[model samples]
Target: MEISEMNLFGREHIKVFKNRPKAITEILSDGVQQFGEKVAVATEEHELTYKELDDLSSIAAANLQQAGIEKGDRVAAVIGNRHEFPIMVFACSKIGAIMVPINVKLAMEEIEYILGHSKPKVIIVEQEFTKKVRQAAEASGSLEAGSRLFEIEGENTFSSLLEQNAELTEAAISEEDGAFILYTSGTTGRPKGAVLSHINVIHSVMNYKYVFQTDDTMKTLIAVPMFHVTGLVGQLLHVLYVGGTVYSMKRYQNEAYIERILKDQINFLFNVPTIFIMMSTSEKFQNHSFDFVKKVAFGGSPIYQQTFNMLKQAFPNAQLHNAYGSTETTSPATLMPVSYPEAKVTSVGRPVAVADIKIMDSEGNECEPGESGELYIKGPMVVKEYWDNPEANLSSFTDGYWHSGDLGIMDDEGYIYIRDRKKDMINRAGEKIFSIEVEDVLKSHPDVVEAAVIGIPDPVFGEKVKAFVVGPSLDPDDFSMLKEHCRKSLAKFKVPEEFEIIESLPRNASGKILKNTLKQVGGEKNA
Candidate 1:
């Protein structure tokens, strides 16, 4: 379908699409009936057919019920990319429970915060990480004495739990009911759960199906972390919705990723540009044949034109797409049409058919074409609210539209180009690093007086975290000590890659850190 045909709103400038499933369970049930024996999902360890997927998920639901889980309860999972991850997600949907996919790389304190905020009735974790979860549970003080903790790996594990229960009767679920609560760092430096509904996820699935032109013949390789919305909704759920096969890896290993693509004859690849760069530069990439690959979609971080051109040469037959969205938008709010790779290479493309995008000024007035402003999105795919966060809701949403906090401009032709971010968030190789979160950790140091963090341009990772600090000492060893302090509380990706000891940070009269000045200072220091 062409973009013009899919645009449901005209001069009014709103976007919408039709024919979304009422609930995610409908997608699961329909997939089973339509593609019963077809391979649905494959991991390094196991593969499941559509019918088998349905049966296993139902069994998982029964097991949860047997453990006292019921509708409206929360189930948090800290497992990696594997067959059980999606199975547990579907099982939660089957029983009308909310799935909370926690980032496995999160530190104990970060995990504790989410556990305390969500108060999940159960937490399913990888065997190796059970101790961390247990610590988090203890720290959060939210886990009841009877709360279940299921390890995904071991003899009596996630798989064995499935075998113990029979198929369960699917619960009646509403389109508006919460399906997943994806946690993202807020401006306040704490993570807020973005509550995505069943309709929200289905809307995203439809958007992916329409934009990617996916069908039953398509075979996808998912190397991105399944806990992230890009991999979960954009890759896994989208492929499931279209009755295609999904080959997932536990974690992205550069060499293994290339091997899997060639081995499985993966036709569709949706990942960030970093993986694409790694694959293209690898000796194995040039030696192997990618003739079977048909489509390549990338997002999460900016893609350089050089990398884009290299990718085109690597997969000659593939159609390249640049997509843009967030956890709040389910997956993609905008996708660059395959036709615009050359002419509009830098733009994030127009809003998806079902999503409305507007660049609004501080006064809430829509900006004229070519003018930059904060991006606001409105659609069924947009998240309803941050779970239990009234402050976030009051600040983020206005007039039924969610403020994206991304500064962008739309050309007269309707293609959107990202200019800058209004929020103090860093995108390092597709991993989000909130500056406040990092700064909070840095300032906790005994010797630290003040800290300011910013994103500095990096050729490989798009942006790398850089911190400027004013402390009692400018000693080089002190920088290492501060980094170690952050390591205990922050994810590896959030740790500042570069640290500069400055006398003082640039600030305005009102005491707000002048980040633009810091960017300039960063550029000068690098120069």
Candidate 2:
């Protein structure tokens, strides 16, 4: 099928969608009125019905106003998977504040950089992370005198702000207004904030609803972090849009995740491939009944064919889907059709109703079917631009399409199959690890002369980081010290899983490191 024909098919599919809300606040209001007594969100500690959610968000909005937050203000949150996170998100929407959800796994330096870049008016964090956030804010000079740092749970916490019974005076929020600023790591060793408007989020949610065929009866167990587009826009917000219930988990523990799936009778689930691999291979997974699950989606990293087959056998009643997207695309631009799982097992499936995907060559010309090229996506679900980063915007977007930097190909039927990456970014499990970022840290060591980082295939994690170094000492003891040095600056996931001493790194005439050669070397060592 032609691209235009595919798009028409998508639009036709979207035409049947009913009762769609224009903004986030409207979604909340509509949910409360329609699903009133139904549960909207739940965690291990508490549950909130739609009506209760509406009431609590109003209080939270009032609290935000009392705390001096104005319309268009940025509010950063460093909390885990909790009920209050969604409350804060809806509260921000009602007041026209931009909610910035920080990734809880980030190191102190990473957090400080985000706080400095976003310069939020208020920082809401869990009590455990309060000191770290405070320190980060202090270092970034974002914690000005009188700026509030509210904890998720504590004496003077987010709940304390809800004590006021004052009526919430709604701000004039528009569909075009920014709703979220999610930070995504860049290849340049810095994080870029993707500004997602209300429209962007709504379109993304619609994509999920249409692709997954979700409804009010659907119950999802959100194992992913809310800071990610998949968990927030795909699972959480989409569930709200359809008047469905969401069971939130603070963290993913294999056993705990399985228990919740069975106990909660979760019908919908979306997680990375690694989580599925762990669950399917576990002894407990065989004993439990997954009869309640209706849909299971996996993305962010490649799934082994063996694991995919095992999941199919494990959940015979559930529709297994493969999704493809990035933070810039909100959640998923493409979702494998449930009906064609076996036929298109390797494909990420076709573009969603609101999205348009194109494969372009280096010269910006569209590639023929089955021809590999960089994938570009255009849609309302795609982020407008990177927050305050003109350089990134200039390079990443062209002719209204966001360059995904992912190498892919499309078949005659419009299904997209991702082949490789155009950038040197590693998908370790589901975590994005840029090689340059780790290489910079490795090169910082005084004993190191030069460093090169490459990703090697792993059975559990999709890929593992391996470093090739040219240093003064090639001893095993010296390499161990180098690994320790990396641990001090980089996240544990980014640290090299294996180290090799090399006299020199192979480079092209332009002096660019030939990472392919290093990948081969690393592969041979693993073999």
Candidate 3:
């Protein structure tokens, strides 16, 4: 594979993968042609081979067309980790419909917001979330007179789509056509939909395939939500592109995850740091050998050094990688190269092959090495703009770069280090403090299982550091011990001024800590 420059999305001279699938539909066609009867995606109860996947998605596409879903129409799905979700993705792609995968874990109100915003012609949902989805559609006025709803297991169901006998018409879709509108995790404010085109997803999948050096033999367990870019594009689509197998879980549990990996001989593993941490610490995970796993990737939050060491011990033969990206970047902006040095584990590696990263200071000047600033990424993999939001498009994107809103520092070796989200950075009397740094230090303690840091209001310093620690049997003495532990590693001001021991931290479906929720908690505690 080579890199080449192309005029894309009305932009001149964007770097793109020279050899890649032209559209989302091409991924399935290539899989069918190459892998044929090989299993493409499977859940606990259902499995679909490459040939069956193609036929079923074609049938579903024809069914959608018969039901008034035309090209450029939005088809929203409230699907969990199941075979139907991926099937729907391909079905929408076949007809050039932009799929909107709404997070199943969201509350009714949140789902309503997404439904209202996307205004899909058809809504497909897993049976478990049908009631909520229907209520949301009704509340949001998305289920207009002509709109339709299909439950995964009901009278009007996803199965019916496969059963219908209709002609599957080939759609005229280009690499620049919209494929998906993934809603970002609304940790701060309302979630915005990042509209990804065919080229955006194709390049992202190619980046994963190229960087991991994966092939058709790759077997991945998709435990993350399919609504997210990590699970959908990074794992599922990436595997489909390489003609590999995908094993999906309805929900991730320690026992099920361990069992599936060992039973299926899963080789490629990509998940959040928290999941890896939980798996590494699980007693069940210790009794088995994970030598079969060849690649391990984690992100969504900073990885603690202790957790990294534990993962190394668990998967000795695995090439551990730290990846950093968001829905806006499709999935990966930076993926740690294979066989990365253990010392560089703290860094999130260099930018992906076609992507360029620049750290820009507050004044918009490019920062020098090791200088902290906002990370700006520009590439074909990056989405052109937020869906239908001109204001966000104007504010978040400049020139060809998307302002990531993430504070980062790139070392001389070109490795990127995420400090914190710009909103998460604390300005305590003009002394900058990144919550990830403090959280990483706190999680290094042997007893601490997880940690979240937020800025609390302070009249003198404007804001002060507050930490919520998760541990087993935490008490007053443990707090003192933890305070001393931080004192030795971090500066006095960087150390948390207030600490509260909680059982767990709140997180969104994407596995990112909800720091805004923490701020609310801090405010309530003070009140």
Candidate 4:
């Protein structure tokens, strides 16, 4: 079958890449020479021009060399969305060190698992999270009980690069060498490390640049956590790849402050649905100017129609764009123009350049037009492998296509619509929550015989968790106590909103609870 028959999404937006780049270093080396003296990264602390970024990266590379880090070494960055974050990634690429961006938003135990598996030579973390880093290190026994962590604040860390020689190093990598190790949400099992090659990294970034028509004139605000591929690939990596300026935000909770900042010089934005939801609903957005903000790209999860429509209301001249991708694909696999209000509201758009998408049924049979099924992608931008994980690598790919594990349908016009997750993962405020984890916790209560977890629609959190428990001796008032138990054991976000004491759970012959049956009977209401 042709690309169109297999992929419901349009083929025009997909970018084809010739897997060649050994590293993304050249994007920076050339960008600095051309856009030198132009602002490349900015935080409240300091601003770096493209030349200075080039210089700092060289220095950081020198430090890495002196520290015994070489080709294929894993370099972890536990910092937030600061200027130092991008610098470290570029520096790692220079010396062939795979960049492993640790999610600072995750719990300490979650952080420990990533650091342990990645085996980073050294960790660059913010001082605020210094203790957490140390704790995580201790938890994993990877570093000394008390390992000294490199700290970054203002331009202080960049000055460390100055202390070293700012000499460039020759690339010692191939297209197959690991360029990045991005951890999955770990919603089900432990997080899997998706190793993206340099060529894959460059392909995804270049796709973002070309598709967005980004240029030196384009300045994007960086608010999404750079630890995720969406943030690293779309906001930080793509900016350097295309010679654009980045106004960095350490955290995005302050919607008003972010709007005040983006109100000024930004022409582009790459944020998740929540970021736009907060901005479009904020009082600050009520008065924000959009003279420069052009293409506002959003992904990570679905956005509500209310939040989608408000974006245009706030930015009368801005065009919305939807980017559909996963950690395994760097950032975007398909990007459809969300220019029209209706399109922006419903479709996730079309498959991006070079991306081949197919929606298949349970038996791997191709779904008909407008039929929802498991989404699979094949492209140069696909991850090379899961680091040190052959079993995961084997399971991840089928006939050279990466199984996205997401249920989606393609329309006649190449517009993709997401239905649900195949793995029973709950998207709570942009964070993936494994239903099994919550179920395990609830089942541990001894009184509960069977438990099933499902995501109920929430206005704020794309989906709020609601667990239905099938057990004896539980009253309506007992739910508060059960919820409290969950609070003590799991993350607050993982705790269920409400619980129903059902006589019995609906189950198939395989003994698997039919969660859809639960949703049919009053589960469609609120969590």
lDDT of each: 0.82, 0.81, 0.90, 0.74
Worst 10 residues of 3 by lDDT: 6-15
Which residue pairs in candidate 1 collide? none
Candidate 2 residue-wise lDDT, 1-527, digit = tens:
11222122122222212344668898889898899999999988889999988888889899889878999899999977899988988999999999999988677888999998888999999998887888998988887745578887775678786776666889987766889999985434688999998877877787787778889988998878887788898789999999999999888889999988888899988887657856865688998778778998888765445557778888879988899888898888999876884767868889987677899998989999988789998876778788899999899887668899888889999999886667667889999776756776776676665677888999999999999988756666787788899999999999998999898777422123667778878999898
Sort order, lDDT high to low: 3, 1, 2, 4
What's each prediction's TM-score? 0.79, 0.79, 0.98, 0.76
List, residue by residue over 1-527, the lDDT tens digit for candidate 1.
32222311112333444455778888778999999999999998989998988888888898888777888899999988889888998999999999999988778998999999998988898988888888998889856645577887753477666885455767899877899999984324788899988978988998888877888888998887888888889888989999999999987888999988888899999887657856775899988778788899988655556667778888899988898999999989999876873878868888988677889987889999988788999887888899999999889887668898888889999999876567656889988666756776786675665678999999999999999987755677877887888899998888998998888776422123668789888978876
- Tens-digit per-residue lDDT, 53-98, candidate 3: 9988999999999888999999999988888888899999999999
Worst 10 residues of 4 by lDDT: 1-10
Candidate with best lDDT: 3
Clashes of each: 0, 0, 0, 12
Runs of candidate 3 exceeding 4 Å displacement: none
Model 4: residue 228 alpha-carbon error in angstroms: 1.4
C-alpha lDDT of candidate 1 relative to the true structure? 0.82
lDDT of 4 by residue, 46-130 (tens): 8999888888888888877776777877887788877788788788888888888887767899889888888877777887887
Candidate 2, lDDT over the whole model: 0.81
Q: In candidate 2, which residue ranges exceed 4 Å CA deviation?
A: 1-19, 186-188, 425-527
